[model samples]
Target: MFIESAGNSLRTIPGSFAVQPTSLQALFSKLPAESLSAGQTLILEGDVATSVFHVVTGSLRIFRILGDGRRVITGFLHAGDILGMSFKSHYIYTAEAITPVTIRRLSRKSFENEIAVSPDLGPAVFHQMSDEMAAAQDQMVLLSTKNAEERLCSFLLKELQRTLNAGALQTAVQLPMTRLDIADYLGLTIETVSRTLTKLSSKGVIETAGRHSVKILKRGKLAQMAGDGDEYEDDWRPATPQPERIRH
Candidate 1:
């Protein structure tokens, strides 16, 4: 009972959520699909948390603006990610489309009511909240301990895993967000992000393809530089070096 819409399956990663997709589809499919062009705001911080959005395609940047006008990007959301999980009345962060995106919206009130009555849905949504917290903890560790180079390396590897999870190539990682977005997310300056990428390229761990894509030339080396060591070494290693190819 998978949630299928527009030829895409909205399935969570195994062990993350025990969702009954048939129920999820029934819960959300009646809602109309929403389309957002790149750079469009999907959810603004401090707005009433009226609904949650399920990403059908493309990417979004989740961030919060500080009182002094600085922005801190909390994370980037890709296909299958959900936003507006706050327990509070107002959203804690803003979600903006980084690429042309398609999503489905479900009112939080309706969602809460349904989950409260549905035994299976209750546990699934709880797991979803736990997953979000784990990701936030990981981001905190990345910012607190990692250097500029390590941060960028870790980011590329993360994007690589996301690419693979989407059933795409293991070596080519697409970065739809701008360097400034990455800088904000990782707590570094845009110049530092550029310089770190350049440094990685010189080391032959990665190569930039056009403005938005990167080819992982040496996964083992990049993972090593990321300092993940055995934690992700096996999962991050590439099967074989393939010819360079860039997607337009």
Candidate 2:
């Protein structure tokens, strides 16, 4: 079923501009699921990245495990977000699931074979890679800032943008991760994170829609607080730096 039409919809995916879905399916057909449980390790630093993954369900975390064994959450993998970054056959970070995950795994040889067979898929994959790199760069800029409130504001703004459509922005976006997760992602203390949200709400930039939800009322103010100048709307950033290199 995955092979039928060779992934017509995959090529059309917003970031997957280069994936020749048909070829991806052809290559993916050779690889199978590893049946990962919740909290399973999918890949780790310094290990050969011999496989690629397409998440079927559940949320996956791509993060760096520090020397002290603390996890720095990089990003979450939902139903989309292809998990493949090939560099000298080694993975820089690791992938684990916040919940039980099912991923379609493809070995490097087979993964590359599909690209070898179909020239179009390579460019498509390259586009997707570039997009991911751009997003990562933006994340670095947010993390690099010394201000925790600024970082938290940026994180919330980004999330809200993701939930918004072109018409009118929603009152709030649903937060999938908890306050601790937000703190970890923003490199802030939980209390600080909570306070930052409170400040934003008090300023009328955002109003609490409900528990685990937020609605934007004064987006312009939120943008100012995030240190992102207000020219673009709907979470558009003036600039997000690209990561020159990410340690695997």
**Regions of candidate 2 where Cα sits further than 4 Å from its true position:** 1-38, 165-171, 209-211, 234-248
Tens digit of lDDT per residue, candidate 2, span 1-248? 01101111212111222445554434343334445556666666666565566666666666777899876777766543467646565677666666766656555565566676677667666666677678889988888864887787787777665554322334557675667767777777889988988888888878886557888777677777778888446553334322112122
Question: How much does candidate 1 score in TM-score?
Answer: 0.82
Clash pairs detected, candidate 1: none
TM-score of each: 0.82, 0.72
RMSD of 2: 8.1
Q: Pick the lDDT winner.
A: 1
Each model's C-alpha lDDT?
Answer: 0.69, 0.60
The TM-score between candidate 2 and the true structure equals 0.72
lDDT of residue 222 for candidate 1: 82
Worst 10 residues of 2 by lDDT: 1-10
RMSD in order of candidates: 8.4, 8.1
Candidate 2 residue 174 Cα shift, in angstroms, is 2.8
lDDT of 1 by residue, 1-248 (tens): 00112223322221112343335435555556667777777666666666656677888787889999999987787776666555678766677779988877666666667777787666666666666667678889999999888898899988887677666645778899999999998999999999989888898878899879999888778888888875554444444422111000
Q: Worst lDDT window (10 residues) for model 1?
A: 239-248
